[model samples]
Target: MKGKNALEMCARAEYGEMRGKNAFEMCAEAGYGEMKGKNALEMCAGAGYGEMKGKNAFEMCAGAGYGGMRGKNAFEMCARAE
Candidate 1:
């Protein structure tokens, strides 16, 4: 609510589908994403290491941030904003 564009800052925050994971993956994983909840994998289908084919898997909780009801990320930071 200022001249600095506060909305932009929130958008930058790593939440929701900021990565290749379900919108509820990050938060839901803490307790539920799946009944297993053993590791981050339970949040999605990471194959085993949260990635595949050099690129992040579609279900990983770490990749690019975008798309609602679908998927955080380190490498995605360098990616051009879609």
Candidate 2:
């Protein structure tokens, strides 16, 4: 997705007010943001997934590197990472 789509997802994922999602879930779906998880964070950051969302550190790394999580390009790349 484009930067605008990432920004929109970030707006919808505001802390504590997420619509049907937790931080990890929202961050993963937004395609950018920071969460916790060393392996995942590094990979996501390297891929520039969260950069568009203004995330200082990449979040949802675990999701992007694993299955059972949602992200666009990152999700597709999970296969190789895993």
Candidate 3:
């Protein structure tokens, strides 16, 4: 677990170094969940999620489902939680 965490930290550091401003900006807009293990509730509170339109929200929901954010109420709950 420690090794895995170290690897993840290294990956995050490399990602930040490579992506620079764009990555940080996107992370700030979308929420740390995109980069870390943030909960669905926290993600829902982010500005990017709030700024999404109907179609975009639907697409995001679909993606989230495939990405392990299961449950019918998850998206709505997250959004409302925000």
Which has the greatest lDDT?
2
- Ranking 1 against 3 by TM-score, winner: 1
What's the TM-score of each model vs. the native?
A: 0.23, 0.23, 0.20
Task: Specify the poorest-scoring 10-residue window by lDDT in model 2.
Answer: 73-82
Q: Per-residue CA lDDT of candidate 3, range 1-82, in tens? A: 1222222322344354333333234333433445343333343343254333222323545445433334323334233321
lDDT of 2 at 52: 38
User: Could you tell me which residue pairs clash in candidate 1?
Assistant: 17-66, 18-64, 18-65, 19-64, 19-65, 19-72, 21-70, 21-71, 22-71
Better of 2 and 3 by lDDT: 2
Count: clashes, candidate 1: 9
- lDDT measured at residue 67 in model 2 versus the true structure, 0 to 100: 55
Worst 10 residues of 3 by lDDT: 1-10
Question: On residues 17-44, what C-alpha lDDT tens digit does candidate 1 reach at each position?
Answer: 5334433343334443243344333334
- Residue 74 lDDT in candidate 3: 31
Q: Per-residue lDDT for 71 in model 1? A: 34
